[model samples]
Target chain A: MDQKRKDSASRSRRRFLTDSTAIIGGAVAAAAAPAGALADDKAPSNGNLPPNVPEWMKAPGADVGSQPYGTPSPFEKNVIRNIPKNQPQYTSSASRTPIQDLDGIITPNGLFYERHHGGIPEIDPAQHRLMIHGLVDKPLVLTVEDVRRFPSQSRIHFLECSGNPSYTAMKGKTASDLVGLVSCGEWTGVPLKILLQEAGIKPGAKWVIAEGADAAAMTRSIPIEKCLDDAMIVYSQNGERLRPAQGYPLRVFLPGFEGNMNIKWVRRLHITDEPVYSREETSKYTDLLPSGKARQFTFYMEAKSIITRPSGTQKIEKGFNEITGIAWSGHGKIAKVDVSVDGGKSWKAATLQEPVLTRALTRFRLPWTWDGSPVVIMSRATDETGYVQPSFEELTKPRGLNSFYHNNAIMRWQIAANGEVTNGNA
Target chain B: MATLKVAFAAAMLSLGMSATASAQTHYGIGRPATAAEIAGWNIDINREGTNLPPGSGNVAHGREVFEAQCSSCHGNKGEGGIGDKLVGGQGTLASAKPIKTVGSYWPYATTLFDYIRRAMPLNAPQSLSNDDVYALSAYLLSLNGIVPDTATLDAKSLAAIKMPNRDGFVADPRPDVKDKRCMKDCKP
Candidate 1:
C-alpha cells in the first residue's frame, strides 16, 4: 500500500472499530476478510509483501472533501446488478443483484436489485406531494418535510419480486441468475398506520391504493389491514437516502410483500372499499394453475433460500469448503434452514447467523468436506409459519409450469467431479 | 397469520398512544387537499368504469394513434417489435410455449384500457388522450379478434366487454407444500 492509501486505510480501520456497536445489520460480516489474507490474487503483482514497507505509505492522500460522497472501493467493481440481455427494449424491466458476490445478508445499496415500471423518474423532493384521499375524514396532502416530521422507525427487511425465479429453470444459469432478485436492507421511515390514523380513515375502508409518481404512475391496491400491520412509508434505505433507481424521496414499504406491492416513487394513497384490480395485480403478478385458473392478490413472497458460495459459475477445491447462503420469508422470520449435500437423500441444519430479524434475510452457514465426487447441494428454508421452501416438482404440481410469478422453488447446485458447481436442474 | 395479528396489536397500541398525544396539541402536519388538486391527479378507472373520463374512439382512430406513438415499440400491427407481442397466443396457455399476450392471458378488458392509459407507448407514457386510449384499446381488441373493426369503444363498452380469460383466475390457496422436517431418508 502507498502512503496515502495506508493513511486512508488506517483511518477507515479506526472508524470501523469505533463504530462497531452502532453498525447495523451485516456491516461486520461485510468487513470479514481475515486481516492477513490477500483478498485477490493480484496482491502478488504489487511489491507490498510482508517485511517490506508498502508503497501506499510513501505519499500523502487527497483531502476529504475531494469526494463529497464516498463510494465502495474500486476492488469491489464486480459487485453489480445485472440486467438480462433479452429485454433491451422494454423500458419497464428488472435487474438482478450479484448475490454470488455478496458476503452477508444486507445487500449493499448500489448492488440492490432494481425493478421499475416506466423507468426511473427523477422527482424534485421540494415539488413532490403525497396526497391521501378517498374514504378519509381529512384528505390531506403531505410534503416531503411533513412526511419526515412523523415519528420514524427503522427495520431491516427483505424485498423480492414475485416473478424472481421464473426465468432460471432453463439449463445453464448461474446462482445470481437464479436467485439474485431478492435483497435485504435497513429501511428507515414513519409507520404508515400513524399517517392513516391522522387521515382518519372511514369505517368501511378496506383497501389502500398506492400510486407512484413515475411515468407509469404505477398503482397497486394493498389491504388496509396489511397497511396498519407494519407497513411504512420509507424515505431512507440502508444508511443513506435511497438511490434514484431504488425510489428516492419516498416509497411505500410493505414488509415481506412482493416488491411491486411496495410501490416505489409513491405519491398518493386512496383508501377504498375494494381492490383496484390494477393491470399488475390481475394480468401480471397472478399465478396461473394447471386448471387454467390463476391466483390473484398473492402478495406474500413466501419462504425461500439459495446457497451463494460454490454456486454456479464458481469452482472449488475438493477439500474443506464452507457452504454459506441466505434465507428469508415474507411471512416472518426464517425459523431454520436445512442443507442437503447429497441431493435430498440426507440433510443437516445450517447455523443461523446472529441478528436474525423478522422478515429479514438471515445468513446461514455449514462446513462440508467435498469427497472429490459429483454431488448436488440444496437448501430448504422453513419460515416461522412452518412453511418449508418447496421443491420445483412440489411447486409445479399445484401451480403448474405455466405460471410466471412467485416461483420460490428450492434451488439445487451440483458440484462436478472436476470441482465446478452448476445448477442441477439446469 | 399470527405475525399479522401481533402486528395489528402493535399498530392499535401505537394508534392509541398517538390519539392521546393528538389530544394535548396537534402536530398540524399535513395540509388539507384542495378539490381541484384531487380532481387533477385522481385518474384511476376501476373495472366498474367508475372514474373513466368521457371519451369514445374507433379502431380506425386507434390504428392512427398506435402507428404515430406506439409503432416504434409495439410494431405496426401490434405483433411486437420491441415491446411484448400484443396479438395471438390465444388458447396457448396450456401449451409448451405459452405466450402471455394482451389477448391470451389478461383477465380483464378494463386492465387493457387501464394499462395503456397509465403506462403504455413505453417511451411516452401517459401521453395519450383518453379518446386515443379508447381507440387503441379498440384496435388491440380487434387485432385479438375480440371485437369488430367498426366497433367504437367508450368507457361503458370497454367495461362491458368480457375478456377471453375472464374466469381464468382463482383465489390464492396457500400452504400448498407440506414437509415433515425429516433429517434422514428425506428422498427415496
Candidate 2:
C-alpha cells in the first residue's frame, strides 16, 4: 500500500514540475512575440530569450570562484533564522528557522541555532589563548596554532539548542516554529584528552569548567570523565574555521551532551576536583521536577525525533509521501525510529538512513501513505541502549509542566483532511 | 458492582502513577558534586560560601583596582558606560521601571562577587587576585549606595551584607494543588 501511494505521489510531483516548466516556456514565448514590433522588446528580440534574467545568472562565470571560507549563496539570504532582539543586556539571542524553507537536518552554519547569553566575542586566533589550569601539573597556555598541532579527529554530529522543548510545550498550537535553530556538520578538532594527557592531569580532578569568552563569560562545569572519553576542543565546523556565532576559533564539543555544555568561543579550562555549580549548571540549565527536587546536571538529551517535513507550517497533499526527519540520542546511536499514524497507539519501525554515527543525528525515512482522512502523525526513537523515547505524557508526568529545559517529548503533527499540517499534542 | 468500581478506580490510579514515574532509577548515574569536584572547576560560586577562595580586600584597595581594571567598560565612577550601569540605581525598582543593576536588581550579593571574579577586567578574566575581587565588590557596593565608601568588604563583611532584592526571588512550586484536579466522578 505504501509503495502504491509513493508511485502516485511521484507521478503527481513529476507532472507538477513539468507543468511549471511549460508555463515558464510559454511566458518566454509570449515575451518574445512582441519583440519584433515593440522597440523596448528589441533588446532581447535577437534571441528567444526572456528579459529580466537576473544579472548574476546571465553570465556563466559570475559565481565566485573557490572560497577558502564558504558562505551561503545569495539566493539563500532569506534562509536566515529570524532572531528576536529584545534587549541589549544579552549578547546572543535565539534565531528560529525559516522552517517554511529548510528541507534537511544540515542547518547552514550561518543559519544554525544560537542561544548566546552575551554577544559573540572577537578573538584573534594568534592573540587568543586557551589556558588549561588547575589540577593539571603543567598548566599550559596554548594558542590556536599550538592546539591545532595536536592530532585531530573529525565526526559528524548535530548540536541542538536546549530550548528544543519550548516549541512543543503548547499542544496543537502552531507558531512560526523551526526558525533555523538546528544544524549538523562534520566537526574537526583535537581530542580534549590529548591536551589533558599532555598537561598531565592530577588525581581527583573529576570536573572541568569550560568557559567562553563572550560578555556573559558563560561557563559550565562538565564531568572530567566525559572530557577524557569523547569530548573534543573543536576549532572547525563543516570543514572550515568555525563561524563567529558558532564559537569561531575554538569551542568544546561534548558529544551526547546538551548543547549548552559544548561551550563556544572557549578561552579557559580549569581542571578542578569539584563542580563549580556555575549559574548555567546549577540554577539555569536545571529542570524543576514535580517532586520539588530540581534535576541537576541533566546532561544527556534523550532519544527524541521530529518530523521536519509535514511539520507545523508545511502543507502536504493527501496521498503517499516520504516522511523524512532526524532522530538523535545523547546516550548512543539511534537503533530504530517508530512512526505512528494513529496517535501512537500503533507504531512501525521506520527505515534509518545509513552511516549512523554514535551520538549523532540519524536521518529516518518512512514511505507514508496519507489518506484523505484527518490523522495525527508522530515518531519515537529507540536508542542503542534500548531506551525508547517516551510520550509527552510519560515525560511530563514526573517532571511536570514547569520545566523550561531538556524537554524531549514526543512531537506530534496533525494532518487535516485538506492536508494542512499543525503541531499538536501526541 | 460497588467493589468492582473501586477496583477499577484503583487500577486507573496505578496506571496514572506509573506514567508519572518514567525516569530511570539508575544507581551511580552521577556522584554527588563533591568539594574536590567543586575545586577542580574555577567557574562557579554559590551563596553558601562554598567556593570562596582565600584573600581579603578593603573598599579603599577595591577603588584603586576598579580604576585600573574596570573603569574602561564600567566607567570611572560606576555611573555606567559601554557595559552595564553598575551603580547609583538603587530604589528605582519600585518607581516606574526598575533599573536592574548589581545593587538595585540582583537578588544576591554573592552573584555579584561570583560574576566579577569569574568574568571581569573587561578584557582579562581570572586576572584579579582574590583581594582585588573583595575590593572591587566593596567599591561597586559603595558606589551603589549599599555601603559607605570607606566600608571594607572582605569574606566576612561581604557574605553578611544583605542584598535589597534578596527576598524578591521565589522558588518554583509545581505539580501541587495548583495543578490538581478535583472531580466527584474522578478516580485517584
* Candidate that scores best on lDDT: 1
The residue ranges of model 2 lying beyond 4 angstroms of the native Cα positions read A1-75, A85-92, A97-105, A171-180, B1-112, B116-153, B157-188
Candidate 1 at residue A150, lDDT?
91
Q: Which candidate number maximizes DockQ?
A: 1
Candidate 2's residue-wise lDDT over A111-184, tens digit each?
67678766678878877767777776566667788778878999888777666755334553332253234567
Compared with the true structure, what per-residue lDDT tens digits does model 1 show for residues A1-426? 899999989998676555543342333443555422343535665455555565445444445685688877544545668878866654688889888888888898988898887889999999999999998888999998999999999999998888877733545367778878888999999888888877876667888999999988899999877887799999999979877888889999999899999888899999888888798888788877766677888888889999998798788898899999999999999999999999888999999999899999999999999989999999989999899888887778877787878888888998989998888874
Q: Which stretches of candidate 1 lie above 4 Å from their native place?
A: A1-46, A167-172, B1-26
What DockQ values do the models have?
0.41, 0.05
DockQ of candidate 1? 0.41
